[model samples]
Target chain A: MSGYIEAGYISVFSVLTLYGGSLIIRVRKTEKKLPDLTEEKKD
Target chain B: MSEVNFAAIPQVFSKRAETATKIIGVLALLSLIATVWLGLFVTPPDQFMGNLVRLLYVHPPIAWVMFVAYGVAFLSTLLYLWPRTRDLRFDRLAGASSEVGVIFTGLTLLSGSIWGRPTWGTWWTWDPLLTTTALLFVMYLGYLALRRLPGDPETRAKRSAIGGLVAFIDVPIVYFSVLWWKSLHQAPTVLDPVTGKTYIHGSMAYTLLLGFVAFTLLYVYFVAKRYRLERLKYLYDRVLLDEAIQERKREAADFKAYGADKKSLVPTAFAENGPALGDARFFGTEEESVVGGGEAGR
Candidate 1:
């Protein structure tokens, strides 16, 4: 019973953390691209 | 000297929204940690399903969040399809929501399967709830594929928008699936549609509510990030296109100007003889002259 409960918690945490981490990575990548995107378009 | 306007494009997301989402994200993480601790250690296990019922803290909220994501995608697609309000921003939003929705939906399916294995004595069954969920997943998988299909931006957006709208039909069907048909799956856990009440009580209810809040905040954060990514890519594409168009215009202008100044057009050559019997005059003003070889100086 305890094993099943622990497994469920682990699964939920893994999914949430991975999804949140991906979002953070993408936001940073896009931020870096912003200035270059503006400069290139203007050029 | 060619002006190809790139001024119409808008930022996919504002800096303020990004910062706000980051704050919400931090709060959401704390909320999730607290909720998990409450459900796992504080709350008592169910008398019927034992500790297996702890899975409830996570699964139902995932279903709710998945619905919200798909709903956002559907509404964005609808806005994009309407002529008066049509814009690429809506299409980008639709794409962002679909991406996040697909991941959450997949998680929901997995969580349900794990829960079922212990409670229902099987990992999966062709129950109404399970069948409909599987169908929804496949349909959105097709929708995401359409987004990446090879086409002009307008064509791709139209296809993906239409695909998203079509796939959204499965959402309502999934929601009503358990009610409209017989199934092993239980009815709504929280917010009973008939009695207008919650099925869970006390500490259980608090944990469930926490799950919903955390999942929703995560969804919003991901959607904003993904939308900005799409917008930056869109802007980069427009820049490349404008640069290419300007280069072509410059080449054409230079050719026309050089031809006029040097008397380099061989207009009489075409009438005197056809292409087969043509002299150097056909390609240039005279023998060995270059027709489109740019201004004569480097």
Candidate 2:
């Protein structure tokens, strides 16, 4: 309700969302560079 | 002699595991949103702390996950150290958990500081609990840095495990700092240490319980994603190294064939640039040479 409460909630949500977004991006980028490991194993 | 078996390294999650991780991620997001809505609009303001007490739902749950993350890292470190169960998977898990722990620990400090600004009349303090927690954050950060240091896989894992063990010593101390010393920080709210009784009741209690579950699920989801990313990065590095080694071997074979046709005593490159190429160690079989080359490159 107050400024401090707003700050705390916003900070938690922003940090978490940013961190989660970065993880997804990094995983996608790395996956693109890599051949499918299961398919490679089959070969 | 302790060569990494890249073939043995898990490169991707099974389809079922991937699907399960996705489900957990979605559940984490949904529950977290619910916790936020309930904490902000639904729960009644505290009798003493007033509306400021809203911060409690997020702060304590984040702190709890910090402890859980570090505890997992410590357990994984111990498993990595045990000879009977030594595995790089445990090492990767430990790294992933510690990284996530660092993020949660950081949020705990930030949220606590925000609350303290109004409650304690200051943004920060040197109180025992606060100091020990800050120390815990820094130490795990050091452990993460140590993991990035260049070395062979086994050496890196062993040293990182040792670093993790050392960093984790601060976790218990951080938890008990409020109890161990006179401090501005309040005692545990959910579960009192002395009487072993919960302080909050009714919807407040349920909301807090939901906060914990939501954050815990989020922590699990983050760690799973991080572990998969770590595996992918390692596999990518190994693939590049294997390619480099294969190229080197091909060059060596071509040079040797050329030298044989010319009836030369030594290849000109080996003669001019020292015996780097001619050395038996350089031409050793892939298994023998990979570890040495990998360590050098790392």
Candidate 3:
């Protein structure tokens, strides 16, 4: 944690993790509606 | 047929992405451990460069991955723009790949400058290879900007594909710049002419190879994640469009049902207009409303 990577890179990794988390949130929201659509089509 | 649904993606794809990610993580850990061991303790200090030469282990792989990333973007863009394969999935993939490529290229440039400061007595250089590599990175940035530009999706894809092809010329130029132009950089030294062998020590060579493989795994994982995100975005937009179209159809149906049961409130020029007007109501309710209002006033 302390030796190889520099302090500046902490910000980079933080931003990447935040970006990835937001992407997951977006995917989940879209996924929730998909099942509802399928159920309606089936009915 | 199997029920292939998009909602189940994270679960369905998790197994493969997880296995791949785990392997990548473990390999990266081992590579880092081995790199530190060999770089710090095992490899003898260089006579001229002192400890600065240790940066070689990081520099070459970052450069290699940067080149590979742009290569992926170039090939994917070509495939995307081909007349037979101009599908939306390919278009999104090209954009995503270029975005990832630009990130890696930025890392390469940053790490190179850091290493250069300690060894070359400067933070930057106008060397041909460095210049061309920088140009390639800027080209990828342009590729990303093309995606964000305002236009219809099809037009954007076509224009971006042309940009991709035009910018990719810098790739080969970056690769061969050392051979074409003399510079402060050393020529490829690992090449052995007579026995056709690179006499890299086993430990150093092994660790560098492992690092390369680990970085490649990381690259693949990143590209897959980006491509998946782009696909989901496309699907989400498509589903919204379909819902809008269905809502419009439902509204049209409701309008027809209302017209059939309700009689006209205003007196008509012809009493027989009831049946004829009904027919027009069903066939051209939207158009009839405009014409009927005009005729009634006349």
Docking class of 3: incorrect
Q: Model 3, B224-269: lDDT tens per residue?
A: 6677666665555655666667679989998887778545532454
Ranking by DockQ: 2, 1, 3
Distance from true position, residue B188, model 2, in Å? 1.0
> Which is the leading candidate under DockQ?
2
RMSD of each: 6.5, 10.2, 7.1
Q: What is the TM-score of chain B alone in each candidate?
A: 0.83, 0.85, 0.75
Model 1 docking category: acceptable
Q: How would you encode candidate 1's per-residue C-alpha lDDT over A1-43 as one tens digit per residue?
A: 5665677668867876787687768766755644433333445
Interface RMSD of 2: 4.6
Count the clashes in each prediction: 0, 0, 0
What ranges in model 1 sit over 4 Å off? Answer: A34-43, B1-13, B257-298
User: What order do candidates take by lDDT, descending?
Assistant: 2, 1, 3
TM-score of 2: 0.86
Pairs that clash in candidate 1:
none
Which pairs of residues collide in model 3?
A: none
Best by lDDT: 2
